[model samples]
Target: MRIAVFTTCLADALYPAVARATVTLLERLGHQAVVPADQTCCGQMHLNTGYWARGLPVVRHHVETFEAALDSCDAVVAPSGSCVGSVRHQHAMVAARYDDDALAERATAVAGRTYELSELLVDVLGVTDVGAWFGHPVTYYPTCHSLRMLRVGDKPVRLLRAVQDIDLIELPGADSCCGFGGTFALKNEATSSAMLTDKVAAVTSTGAQVCSAGDSSCLMHIGGGLSRLRTGIGTLHLAQILASTREHPCPVPEPRRPARRRPSLPGAAR
Candidate 1:
């Protein structure tokens, strides 16, 4: 199968390795992976930030970039569920706002070929284990957009469970948001911080060395909170874990001091 990797803007800038891992995992599974250079932001940040007028050009750029690859490849996969959701769910809304009939048509075609990592793996590739070999207990944080908007429940968890040497733990309150809704963080700083504190507390409660999810943007936000608190817990994207093997291990942050105690959930902490 010919597949194109749409490395979202956040991944391109902050998590390039995640993008590489996504391609590596696909190729290891005996498929062709393509990275279209022109791919950029999926206009999700803008769309969510209520900058519809400012998002049109970005929407156009992304649509054009992915449309070419979508026409050629059997599927277009992204490591980010959020980005895939944007392309699949929001492109039509954005296109319609401008009344650009061509853009709207192109948006529909492009969105059709895009799939989040788990969707491609379990739905298209028909495999749970991507033959991963990460040896550690990992906790999961389901990103809000992917969980609520995309409704990509259990796809990631199912794949994680299939990996050899992986101990997947249930994150208490795993469905709660990580408080990083793009501009939501900036617009409501205190509320965001409070919410992030709750998420970090949940991460610490997991007593696992790593916290992972399908979205890197959420990881960045959660990682930043953990980093700030000087907690040793690390955040990883699910693709990174799925891509790990005994030969080529997923790059994890070096271990620091183990957490002193599992943090209690809000209102329950003593």
Candidate 2:
């Protein structure tokens, strides 16, 4: 199958490795992966922030970019469940809100072809194990969008379980949101922090050195909190974990370092 990768904004900016891993996994499975340079954010941030008007252009651009790529690719795939969920669920809503029937129909058609990485691998490609191997204690946290919005249950875990020598641990409160609902964290910092505290505690209790999730946003929040506490646990995208192989094992990521505190001025108190 010829697959086109929809590298979301978060992955493009903060987690390019995850996007690369998605492509690597697809190619390793004997499928071609195409990444169109014209592809940009799916406007999920705008839509989630209630700026449907502002998001329509972004949604339309995405549809146009992929529609063109469809000439060479059989399907569109994204490592992010959140972005896929937006394209599948929110794009059409934006069109309908504005009563753009033509755009709505087009949006629906494009959404139908878009798939989360695990969905494509298991349902479309008909393969569980992609000959991957990652020998370490790891746990998975199902992101909110992937779980509730996309309804991609067990598919990611099923793929992880098939990895050779993988010691997959069950994460306590695996379905709980990691307190990173995009702008929600910024809007409700205190509440977000409290929720993150619980998530980090649950992750630590599993005694897993690494935590994996489908969405980079959640992983960034969870991983950042863990890093601040100096927990020594790392966060990885499912794509990176799945791309690991016996010949080329996924290297354990270095613990994230906390930002350095700036020095006080000469007259200021220490």
Which residue pairs show collisions in model 2? none
Candidate 1 lDDT (Cα, 0 to 1): 0.88
Q: Worst ten-residue run, lDDT, model 1?
A: 251-260
User: For candidate 1, lDDT tens digit of each residue in 1-270?
Assistant: 999999898889988889988999999999999999887888898898889888889989998888788777998999988898888888888889889888988888888888899989999999997899889889998888778777888999999999898878898888878888888899999999999999999989887889999999889899988888878888888888988999989877753554578778989947
Off by over 4 Å in 2: 256-270
Candidate 2 lDDT, tens digit per residue, 1-270? 999999999889989999999999999999999999999989999999999899999999998899889888899999989999999999988999899988889889888999999999999999998899999899999999999999999999999999999899999888888899999999999999999999999999998989999989999999989998988899889999999998988898889655678988899976
Q: lDDT of all predictions, in order shown? A: 0.88, 0.92
**To one decimal, what is the Cα RMSD in angstroms of model 1 from the true structure?**
5.8
Off by over 4 Å in 1: 255-270
